[model samples]
Target: MRSKVLITGSSGKLGKRVLEFNEGLSFLSPSSKDLDITSETSVNKFLNQNSFNTIIHCAALARMMECEENPNKAFLINTQGTLNLVNKVRDIEKSCKTNIRFIYISTDGVYPCINGNYDEDSPTIPYNIYGWSKLGGETTVRSLENFCIIRTRFFDPLNIPFSESADDIITSSIEIDRLAKIINFLVKDEFNGVLNVGNEATTEFLRYISHKPNLKKCKRSDITKNLNFEIAKNASMNISLMKKILSS
Candidate 1:
């Protein structure tokens, strides 16, 4: 029998893409209203009614500025909300005597972006509230026997959003469609622990400006001067492990 999968945050871009690339797996995709992860009672009520062998948790307070402005709300949803799901999953798995795999969507922000080339064993000192909140969620997911924490950044290539691209700023941000494909493959792998996925170290302008011809090339200052929070500089992650897994 195919694994019964529960996909949270199906409304989000990543979640939606994952659903699109189902890869012949059985999926139970629910919107935020149907399964409010922030509410422990709501999570329990929903999961109790269904049985799942895998959970691809993509729900999160993902905005950087919003997380910084409202740290409490960020933690409530990203941290506490993840804990609620983890706890309940444990209960259900124990009762049913079946293994449940959890795939957590984490951010590359968990690493200090001071210098790039971060490996899986590198220090995890978050530079912002968004990273901290996701790290808290990671802590809970670690308690599970089978879990994969994907730490990377992804952007919709079609929608660059910004008119200016910083040539100096670098990141491990991959195209949304590519990242979704990797996640679809990861769902079947039995790997436990964090897996860094994305392109090699490259400037933001070169990676992002290709899709937008009108986008002007600029220095990092031109972008950060207007923003309140600091955009991660050189947030590149080493994806050697990810490639190995995909190849295997």
Candidate 2:
């Protein structure tokens, strides 16, 4: 049977790219106005009315500085918001007696970046409010019988929003288009649990330069020193699993 997919956060960058790349697939990309995920009634209403076997959950208040300023709002949308969807999915699955594949877009920020090269088995110690909020969402998704929590860094290669990037800090960040492709693959795969998704460890500046050679370089402290909260120092992941999946 052809899978019917429902992609949340369709307006967002990653969500939009996912839709663009998977043009051949049967996808339902709804706006927040049409389906507000933070509202239980709204989510339940949408899910009940729509018939889909796959869910790509990408909705979250992911702004790091904003999350730091208002942690409660972060948790409300990220943590409680996810719980709302999970509850509805469980209900739908029970009533319909059909499997629903849930693909959650998580972050490498959940790792303790004090030491780099963390894997799926690594201890989760978030450095900032954004990280903590996402980690909360991941906790709820784990309860679902069929779910995949993808932990990775994602950045737009065409649109690097910053004039300068950190040279000192390292990450396993993947391009937005590639992220969309990989997630689509996972949606069809039998894989579950956390998968570290990204490229080899490289400085943010180096990754940024690949697309923007003229971009200026800066240290991590140069940016974080002005901020009140902490940022990931070296949140690079062991993406052997990601590579294995791609190769297969």
Over 4 Å off in model 1, which ranges? none
Model 1 lowest lDDT segment of ten: 223-232
- The residue pairs in collision within model 2 are none
- In model 1, what is the error at residue 125, expressed in angstroms? 0.8
TM-score of 2: 0.97
The estimated TM-scores of all candidates read 0.97, 0.97
Which 10 successive residues of model 2 have the least lDDT summed?
Answer: 20-29
Tens-digit per-residue lDDT, 1-248, candidate 1: 57778999889989999888888678998888889999988999999998888999999999999999999999999999999999999999898998899999999999998798898889999988999999999999999999999999999989888888888888989999999899888888878889999998899889876788788899988877877887788899999999899899
Clashes within 3 Å, all models in order: 0, 0
Q: List runs of model 2 lying over 4 Å from the truth.
A: none
Candidate RMSDs in Å, in order, are 1.0, 1.0
